[model samples]
Target: MGAFRGLAAWVVVVGVVFLVQGWLSDGALVFGDDDGLVEYESVETSELMMDAEFGHFLDRKLLQVTGSDRSNTTIRKLVVRGDRRDPTNGFKKYRDGYDVKSSHYWASVVYTGVYGFAIGVAWLLLGALITLLACFRCCCCRRKMPYAPRNRAYFWIPRILAFLLSLFAIGVIITMFIRNRQLHTQAFNIRDSIATSANDATGAVRNVTTTLTTVETLVTKYNIQGLNSGIIGSTVASLNNQSDTITNKVNTNIRTLNRLINGIEIALIVMLSITLFLVAMGMLAALMGWRTVYFLIILLGWLITALTWLLFGLFFAVNNVTTDTCQAFTEYLQAPANTTLDELLPCVDLATAASASNVVKQGVNNIVLQANNALTQIEQVSASLGRPTTLPPVCDPIGAAPDFNFTTCPNGTVLIGGVPQVVAPYVCPSNPVTTACLAQGRFVNSTQEATIKDLSIAGNDLVAIIPTVNALTNCSFVYDTFSKIVNERCPPARKALRNLWISLLLLSIALTLLTVSWIFANHRNKKPHLIHDQEYSPTGTTARVK
Candidate 1:
């Protein structure tokens, strides 16, 4: 009885301790359920800034396609729509762009942390309950229960339950992680699709522009001017030749750009689908872990569950992945609208050319004189309409070196006695026909030069984006945040659970061995009692009396 009292006192002390532990850990008494769910909303101002920045980024690419940086040159005023003009002022003062939350990795980190905390709190409670139940049965209940012939069952059940629950928790984490990963991958495909489409459009516009400029240049460069009866016969031939060159170049660029766009679109669609499927699978896997009940079937189930949770972090990191998207211009070229072949075609006065040349011999003197004057007047008007040649280079020619003491010329242009003169600037000659030809040639060269410059700049912008984009892809907020939690919250929490599991398993095994030993010890003592009773029967008592 004293032994029983001592055992009961020990059980009470243990029970109180376990109850207190439960309250501190898994119990509802200490912390509220919402303790871990706190998060901050993205600032509206920041979001607007983010949107503007992206718009500028887009505009810069568009400008690049047309041989300009109108977008980037004007970007500072456009995108930075806040009190502080400088980034050095910090994010607090700056308005964010479109998809502000998505743009910042820190947002992802916060989200991951909150998610981990909430889920961890729940799992902590489960562990506490498991520990309490396990401790109670081991210390108190087993002692009072009747010893059945096969009593190992009672000792093993609670341990199995603890192990199974731990495993389930781990699996839930994995599934969520995988789902997040898939979402991130899908976002990448979407971004790529948009970029590819934009690139193709830019290419097409550039190609057509270049072809038109080239055709215009060919007509003007060979001194081909004044199309009339004499030249009219060859004018159509010249136009045809120019047109063929333009057509071939345009067709080649368009075909190439179109093919690239088609391939990218197909690839993006396939990848998006695959990513979605992976997300769904991850979710399904988590659900299965949640519902799993049997530990024996889920060998290493706890580890898998931990991995699942870790995967949730991975998914967050991946989904939050960002990359730079810009227009491709170096791969294409653009020309101005007015530089096309149609614009370069000369306006011919066919009647004047034909009638004057044939009928002037037969006309009256006044009519011939009047027609010549009219022709001269028309020629003056045409020359006036052409680009002016009086501008510097057109009016001046290089003279022989003057006999002077000075020797060197200025950097940009030839100089006499080291004096600076502007280099030969573009100029049109005074001859109406020649001036028209020169104008066309200048227009074509200028347009093509501008187009190539713009395209090349655009290419550089896109390439510059590659490193920044790649950087975004390589770094993950979710992964960083989750890893922090693992080091801080998860690792320790899991270790506690694992230790608890091991202790339970060992306790159960120990109980099982003790029970067997106790039974054997009792059986042997009973056999001795039975033999004594038999030996002390009536016949033996009578023999003792004699």
Candidate 2:
């Protein structure tokens, strides 16, 4: 008992050492700051909305409108200020009055690791001291005191209670293990969902860029009349930049989230495994009458039980923060505009989105109209030269402004899909058509005919990508991604975190009680004897009489 008291005193000293280290490392533990905390720089909203490909294309168009160099600043150039961490490397406070930079927050985040290390060292010292004391007492004190023969119930009762407590602790550990696995699985699902959505958006942007490059190549190679390859080239450049930015951002987010999830997973696994092993060994030692082993197990188990309580506190704080963040995210999804989330994912107003769509539609229509007008001039010139050709006009699939739907074209224009069929008979059969065939063929040469065919294919490609551009620019994709996270993923993840926290709490209680029961059982096993009748012989051998 004296040795056990010394061990407890040493543990208390080690705990104080750890407490002091934490306090010094984290500075003072002031709660709330009287002075307001520094705020992040505000991202200025622009009149022209920029999200994905549309934003890049609009940046070019804005340059054209202002008649200025492309160096003009745009809203997309502003860096996002969300996802900032506090000095403690924990999440930043999302609301007013909370000082995440305070030492109190840091302590809450890091106390488990600090104190767990301290308890580990304390346990090692305890084991060494206990072994040394046991050796000293065994070598010097040869006389054995007879343990009292109490009722058999006295022996069986503590053993029974310890056995029950050990069983309960094992049950709690198993439940915690299962809950931790569930939490890990839920975290992975959320990560996968985020990655999928971001990749989809990136792929859509890249597709649009690729198609535009095709269009630009055809226009430049063919030197098609009235079509400017330079504009297409610029739009492609902007899309490339947007694609790179999106890819880098997505990769960074995924890596960060993966690291965080993996760290938590490893911590939980290590803590639980050690705890279960200690509890099992403790039960085995107590049952087998291994005094030294039992003492060592008790020391280790005491450390583990205390560490479990500290872990519970850490997880409890984390769960609260997670719940708060989820609630804030849900609120942001409900009303995104003018919210803090806008700093992270700024969205354009409806009018700006509509304007962006109109610009794209009008650009497509103008390209189609120019192609048709150029074709008209070729036919009129051919007629003046007494060689009227039978070329059909190219159709504008995007019918009109404000609602670009694939409707029937006006008479004399061939639908984009039917252009090859109509123009097949009119394309020159060879590089040099006979005078009779020149009058029938639409092209003066094979190259001209090939160029026109290429133009038709490019036009079709351009028209196909307009809808994607519209969707990206309008921010519907952004809202849909957020909606999925908030509605489908957030609740389940939050619930899993809550359940994991509760399990940790329960395990902490069970391990603590189990440690107490071990101590009680050890005391019962070493109970003092009353020495009812005794006779000492000359050789110092004592005899007991009934």
Highest TM-score scorer: 2
Model 1 per-residue lDDT tens digits across residues 49-120: 212321211112212212244334321111111221222334343333212223332443334333434443
Query: What is each predicted model's overall lDDT from 0 to 1?
Result: 0.30, 0.59
TM-score of each: 0.25, 0.64
Against the true structure, candidate 1 has what lDDT? 0.30
Candidate 2 residue lDDT tens string, 1-546: 999985675565445433533443234322223421222111122133333532221111111112243246332111121222333444453212122334643443343233334544564566467668879988997465655346767766766776766766666666667778888888888778767766776777778778767776766665544345665565666666666666676677678889989999899899989988888787776676566777777777877776776676566557545544444454444434444343333344444444434544665676676567656766786777687766677778676656686566689877554555655655667767666766664454677667557766777776787777776675556666666765577667766775665666566666667777787677667645435576444355676766
- Quote model 2's TM-score: 0.64
Residue 282 shift from truth in candidate 2, angstroms: 2.0
Relative to the true structure, candidate 1 reaches a TM of: 0.25
- Candidate 2 pairs with clashing backbones: none
